[model samples]
Target: MVNTRTTDYWSQFIVDYSGGGDFFIANAYGKSAAQLSYDRVLFGSALQVVENIKLINNIIVVDLPVSAFQGLSLSPDDRAFYQVIADNQHLTGYEDLSSAFRPKKRIRRVDGPYEAEYFDGVYSAEKVRFIKLSRKLIEGELQVGVVVYLAQTLQSRNEMAHDISVKALQLVSVIFTIALSVCYVFIWFIVRPIRRLNTVLSERAPTDLTPIDTDAPKEISELLRTINHFMMQLQNTLDRLKHFTSETAHQVRTPLAGILAQSQNALMENDKPKRHSQITQVIDSCESLSRTVDQLLNQALLAHRFKSKALEKVWLGALIKEVSRDQVLTALQQKVELAYIGPNDDCQIVGDTVALKKMLQNIIENAIKYSPKQGVVEITLIIEKNREINDIRPRYGHS
Candidate 1:
């Protein structure tokens, strides 16, 4: 059997067979009237010439079927035909979509994925398949707008899906950003107050039992309670330390003083050089022991005053003068010269008067002890003017 391709039946037969309208032909072959008629009806559409053109391949080509051209001249049917094609959401089968298909047959279903070219919009899953087939069966290549034509009725649906996706993404992004901001603020509120409390705890306050502003960020209430608990422990430790030092000093100082006095008296009574040397060594040992006890007592007193914050304000000048006066007699006994060089008038400083007196007396007594016979010990008090008054404890060092 001879295979005929692309029909070209005569006009008179085209008019008779096609209800007397326009015609189009498929390219490349001549066939008997009987054969073309069988081919056309079998193909499900009639073939007639709408345009007759010569092909470089030495073939005459006429495109589409007679019915298509017949409807093209009828303006009302033209739009309806296009509309029907667009609404006809039917797949052209997988065989047409397959890359290898190159059929000599031209009349096939123009409903598939290829219709995207006619309508440049997104398509429904069913509609997308229809346009895909249309391009393979009719236009012979996949086209951009062809898919659009098949799926155009479903354009609103595609747009709605797209908008929903974008809106959902935006909502997620906004929610995350809001959550992050809230978390940042929450943490800052918790940390800032706790940090302030930490600063206060580290500093040397006047007392062990002194109450601090316990208010803090509410988020970490447990952490604040822990710090308060630690503070209580610290106060207990300080109290124990102060009591121990005071008790130890009292216990050891009285006996040491008695021993020092007895040693001094024995040193004077001993006439033998060897005996005098032994007595002097004993006196030195007693003196050293007394000094150590005095130091411990003084430190314990200072700690106690710090705990109570009972350090009273006194005239620094009167304080200095009293220490100087006491030192004069000691200086005279030691055969050392004592002098003062500072402000003429009273200078006020906030501190415990007793502790201040003791401190000043200790310094002067030390000066008298260390200075050579007939040496001058100068005591100076410098007053700095400032709004906030503080105790200027003078530290003496030998250069």
Candidate 2:
């Protein structure tokens, strides 16, 4: 394709200069005269092309002898192009025109031309492809060559592709920025409720066992429910502890006060018998106080153990009889008859031993305290299918 274009351009150049080459051929005599004609016509044509064509730029016609370089009307642009060729003498792929004029290098009638590239001044050191044409002088052995060049800059060619690439990069950057913004918004929305919940909990007093309220995200609703459940359990535990503390203080204070009063009475009594009786009552009060403290401590320990204790098969009758022994002292003091009568065989049930003992101890102690003096307090263990305990305590005022 480049060969065809070069051939066509060479033909057009020959046509443009119709009579110029013939004029030189007619007046020529010796080799020097032919070289003179060569210099005159080639330089003339270059000047003509520069003047006539407004678009043509960056051209250099060389090998026309240094002597012939003088006496030519040159412009600033033309001088600059000539200087560029002179400076970079070894510019690839542009060779000196003198090489084509070598004496041994014969030019065949039907030989194809080749192309080369050189830096054009208008394009600032950028190589532009040019068509080189050489013709041997018929009258002499000297050869003349002309390099027809087209100057091209980096800024030219495929402007649309460059623009499209730039726009595509900008669009991708914008999309990436938008994606990051969306992720940040989503993360903040999800974490806002949890952060607020933490702040509320941290700011609250240690005694405050209130359940938390929040409009949490649906993804963490189950977590919120679990937290609320824990809070409710905590509140129940706190309430139980408060009730137990108050009851223990009240129960313990009564026995301690009885001991104090009995001791004072024993110290003041003049009769030895009365004083001895008062001393005995003080001793009894101390024993009752010690039992109450031990029971309260055991109840607290039992409450703590309820969560982790394993269930064991326990005989209900034996458990009842053992617990009844503790209350015998209270029953005797109250003048109430405490009797346990149940099945002699193994009445097995699955339960925690400590929990059941505490339960029975509480029931029998209440029964003996409430029963009338010398009244029968019968304790019976009934193993039923549905697993229920029916308490049949005697009426307070009954015979």
Lowest summed lDDT over 10 consecutive residues: which window, candidate 1? 20-29
List candidate 1 stretches off by more than 4 Å: 1-272, 385-399
Clashes of each: 35, 0
Expressed as tens digits, the lDDT of each residue in 117-211 for candidate 1 is: 12222232223212222221223332221111111132333333333433444454477689999999988876888788778777846585554
lDDT (C-alpha, whole model) for all candidates: 0.50, 0.56
What is the per-residue lDDT of model 2 for residues 79-151, given as tens digits with 9 covering 90 to 100? 2123112222432322433232233333222223332223222234443212123222222443323333322
Q: Quickly count the clashes in candidate 2.
A: 0
Q: Score every model by TM-score.
A: 0.35, 0.42
Global Cα RMSD, each model: 24.4, 21.5
lDDT of 1 at 170: 44
